[model samples]
Target: MARQRVPEGPTPPPAVQKLRIRYAKRGRLRFSSTRDFQRALERALRRAAVPMAFSAGFHPHPKISYANAAPTGTASEAEYVEVSVTERVDPERLRAALDEALPDGLDVLEVVEARPGALADRLQASDWVMTFRGMPVADLERAATALLEQERVEVTRMMKSGPRTFDVREAVVSLTASPAEDDTCAILRMVVRHTTPAVRPDDVLSALRAVAALAPPTPPLVTRLAQGPLQTATATVADPLAADQAGDGT
Candidate 1:
């Protein structure tokens, strides 16, 4: 009788550094749920040979923390995650490696060494761009006006408990409509405050429908442009990765 020999390799080093990453979900990958993306990221980290940290327990898991995940079925350019790694790798190099490892549409845009303070707390609001196909721009503009005039717009969402109604207007910091490709397709840009339940793009669309009877022939394509501390003076969100990028000089 003969026993098969097992090969042994050096154990992975402990994760001592935390790196924050900004990635995108585009095209078909936008349909992937949070769980689906998490699994994909884990696989990508392995494939890219990212020295990710693991928890200490019977069932050890990677020390990856996702912050402010955009809702499923929506494309985004600013999705963020903080990953603990054993070695200190250059952020740009890490970004390139992960981008190459992951699928095409699920792109890794930026990677930065995590700074002090919570990423969630720094993110006060989100800038969303909604594209409406086969919908008049004028109708969307009118809807925005109508919605702004109203003090509150309530919408019902099906929660774990049951259907819960909340005011969508109170969460809206600013909403404006403009032309996209043509008159039939309108682009709506909105900066919405992060609320308790989180008012989504659909919620704002529902409010538009209630106000000015604005409806699209097809489902609107929604993309989150950015999420960070909102500048009251200019009405824009500061780049969450700016501080890290500045320090890296890349």
Candidate 2:
């Protein structure tokens, strides 16, 4: 067998600093797949002249880590990623540059120097809001009540291996329904704990259908409002990057 030669060169420098970014997916950008976002981000980094650290290998890649990205079709205001850079850069400046480089709907909202702990660990829960048109708030309230009354809501999702079923009721911390301003639409706000296999908004919708026979005439528009540590008492999500920002004395 013939041996392939490895490309030889001086190795890339070790990362000097790490920055965590909070970005938003809105409008049409919510439909972008994770891989699409990755490609766009890499191009934006290049255009913004970020000093990204590279992996030491024949096929070197940027040192970027994504944590618990929202499902492709759902919009999110709190998607997170961490990046390592060879040179220290001002977080605000980087945020501005990256926001300008990327398309309008994929926005960089905030950036902070990483603190001591893992970013993923801080993401303990998510707050989601789903809007349904032509659905009355009274019907939604009844369905939410039924879903909460259940001991368990088992839902199935098709995985790569096969179909798998799990109880989504335990993961739901709180669920509430309200009338939208238009009076013709209904809105549901829920706080769900991040769990194994990750219960999604769609799974909850399925559970509602199974439990209360509530079905929207049109597809519900779902958006994740926040992703961070869960406050047990209030059933709310706190800012994940607050600790890192505190470390910077900002």
Candidate 3:
């Protein structure tokens, strides 16, 4: 039996989207929050005239997504952001365009274009460098030793679901401290959970306060050593801890 067949039109080609982007951190601008960064980035993208994809609506804005944002006031050498555009563009040209529009301190190191539907889990980990100044060498050693001694150190986490506790040990895949060659303060290198159960410089600060007696009630200085995997980016130091991570530049 031949049923009446309805004619179907040809399938429309998938819309090509282009994302011109660069990652940035708000150092000493912690008050700005993640929303602030997004606003600034969108503004920069439009100002740079980078081709962008916009959602259809009365009021529309370019399509952009930030990978993972660093906490404010903490400088990071590495970060990630993804942008979407309607047209394909060269990475180098896109980089140059964004660079011109961005101010000093904000840099676009790479502009690689990824195809739609591609898995965004390409990034693995981020390296953070913190300075715990004024902590005596003895106290610094004790805190680090205590951290490494146990298989897991339960740390309370603040979540919308309510207060949750997680093992900082498992997340802290690597940790180390050393005397700087040119500086008087101690250098701490840490790689903690990024995707979930995110840790910050303040956590380490808390540990130092608890375990070290000679340590200061407050840190003298703090800086993000580097963020993102080592292979895709550079590191602040070339120590053994960072080498343990599969993706961290060995």
Candidate 4:
């Protein structure tokens, strides 16, 4: 005899779908991938008594989606996650409940109803602010000049399956370096493609390193600047891959 599938009842009236979360990754935890955070958040939601929609299967789980996962060892003041709920709860109350269960470093800033459209749909690119120690202004300027003058910068590497090439020139919307408060350190403000072939802070660090040496190595720390649609406010966003020529290392 074959096992028969149990029929589920009619779906409940569509309670408005919502994903309530705003976060910033800080401290050593910046090294944790987005997937790890997803598990952590899922646990937190269940502990908070937040109701969630489950898929129609034996091993179903609450539907939760994260916008973008920040790179490991990189701190980000701006991060976001989307979640679904069947019951409407006061934003403040929901936030408070989650906060009590959330660990330190993972701050719950807001629980606003996500505006229409998925985050991936709304996001055009990400801004990254990176700091490197022991880099002088002159050398920094030279590297920037070399990188920008080029039409495109292609960085090659082996992926999960095989080797691949990526164009980062256009991916970098804007690249600016400034003196950090530490003086010996410099900061890079950049906008990169948020999509797959996703440019990372390490990529930028490598670019600068290729032109000039960076101090205090060992997987330099990274921090997410922002994730959203790019606009007239700065460096023009273009497909770095679509760009004509790419430069050294990456």
Number of backbone-clashing residue pairs for each candidate, in the order shown: 0, 0, 9, 12
lDDT tens digits, residue span 6-46, model 1: 44554446887889899999999999888988988999899
Off by over 4 Å in 3: 1-22, 26-31, 57-59, 115-119, 160-162, 211-214, 225-250
lDDT of 1 at 143: 92
Rate residue 127 of model 1 by lDDT: 96
Model 3, clash count?
Answer: 9
- Each candidate structure's TM-score, on Cα atoms with residue i matched to residue i, is 0.90, 0.96, 0.74, 0.82
> Candidate 4 at residue 77, lDDT?
72
- Where does the lowest 10-residue lDDT sum fall in candidate 1? 4-13
Choose the strongest candidate by TM-score: 2
The best candidate by lDDT is: 2
Q: In model 2, what lDDT does residue 191 have?
A: 99
Q: List the residue pairs that clash in candidate 2.
A: none
Report the C-alpha lDDT of model 2 over 1-250, residue by residue, as the tens digit.
9998876898999999999999999999999988989999999999999999999878899999999999989999999999999999999999999999999899999999998899888899999999999998999999999999999999999988999999999999999999988787899999999999899999999999999999899999999999999999999999999999889422
How far off is residue 164 in model 3, in Å? 3.0
Question: Candidate 4: what lDDT?
Answer: 0.68
| Candidate 4 residue-wise lDDT, 6-97, digit = tens | 65665444446575477777786777677778777888888999877665555555767776677667898768777778877776777888
TM-score of 1: 0.90
